[model samples]
Target: MRKILTLVIIATLTLGYSSLNAQNYKFGHINSQELLNAMPDKDSAEAKIKKYAESLQEQIEQLQVEFNKKYQDYLQKRNTFTDAIREMKEKELSDMQQRAQEYQQVAEQDYQRFQAETMKPVIDKADAAIKKVAKENGFTYIFDTSSGVLLYFSDKSIDITPLVKKELGIKE
Candidate 1:
């Protein structure tokens, strides 16, 4: 009975020690924001969004010019207008101004949606590449330094930016 008890204890310690040794964690980190910025897809997406914004701005400017022209005309001829005409002109100007403001608000919202939609695939590609690199390289925990959520990481934390870039076929 004593010999069997000793054997059981030795077997338990050996298995426990081996399990502890097998729990070695490999930590890696990558700056995902920098990776996304470096992607060519992102550059194209930015250019497209910029062009859309410029077009929206041009439309806004046209609305402003139309408003200015009517306002100037109303100011010049206010005394010539009958009371009814004057009130109608003022209401038109007010409605035009309101429509322009609403248009601006809508344009702002559309721009935001456009930006997010255009950037989604680019972001997803970067994320997939990061994930592939992490899994292939046996990273137990891959932290995103770009998120700003990670306050500090020691020098030993691996920066896998190059690996992710390579995985994504990005030279830069």
Candidate 2:
């Protein structure tokens, strides 16, 4: 009986170990920044952002020029103006300055929002492609190498960039 129990225990342990060794995990890595840069839509989106920023800058420049002219005029004619006119002119300049500042803040926020809106589709497409490649290739983990946080990934880690690009229908 003792010999039979020992054989049973030994067989059970072997089977358990074999089952554990049968499981497999695959890892993949990709430079997502490179992928985003390679996307054509990103270039057009950035161009649009640049043009919008330039337009905002131009409007701000116009405001500054107007403020400067008013300031110079006030300085030249202050001696001839009554107290009420002087106060009114100062208040007007102050109001313009305040409005310009407010507009700048709002412009910055609008720019951020526009950038996110423009980039969302491109990002979403890239993400979907990555996921599709991962699932299709049986990858257990796909890490982004662009952010610089990953300290050590062995050469054994498969590069999935090309696969993802192909999934996205991207050339080169």
Candidate 3:
């Protein structure tokens, strides 16, 4: 009976140890920013945004120049005008300023929408590639180290940036 109890205890310990070893997970880290910067689509998106912003800026500048000209004219003629005409001119200036402000706000919203639309596909592609790479390599979890969310990771965790880049057919 003593020998049988000892064997049972040994068997239980062995199974527990093996179970613990089997629970080991494969983890990896990557810099998402690096992946984004390396993508060709990102460059095109940036160029498109830049051009759109320049066009909006040009329109704003035109509005500003018109406002300045009108203000200057008002200043020059205010001394000679009747009180009623002066009030009318001031109202016109105020309306023009309000319109310009509204246009600026609209332009900003449009730019933001455009940027989000342009980046969605690129971001989706990158995410797919990352997921594929992680699965292919048997990684249980892949963390974005560049996002500043991870406080600590062991050296044993693999850096899977190159693998993801390769999976995406990216050169660098």
Clashes of each: 0, 0, 0
Q: For candidate 1, lDDT tens digit of each residue in 64-90?
A: 999999999999999999999999999
**Candidate 3 residue lDDT tens string, 14-128:** 9999999767889999999999999888899899989999999999999999999999999999999999999999999999999999999999999999989988999999999
CA lDDT of each prediction against the hidden true structure:
0.94, 0.92, 0.94
Best by TM-score: 3
lDDT of 2 by residue, 1-172 (tens): 9999999999999999888865577889999999999898899989998998899889889989999999999999999999999999999999999999998899899989988998899899899999999999999999999989999998878999999888877899
Q: Please estimate how well model 2 matches the true structure, expressed as its whole-model Cα lDDT.
A: 0.92
Off by over 4 Å in 1: 1-23
Clash pairs of candidate 2? Answer: none
Q: TM-score for all predictions? A: 0.85, 0.85, 0.87
Rank all candidate structures by their TM-score, best first, as comma-separated numbers: 3, 1, 2
In model 1, what lDDT does residue 52 have?
Answer: 96
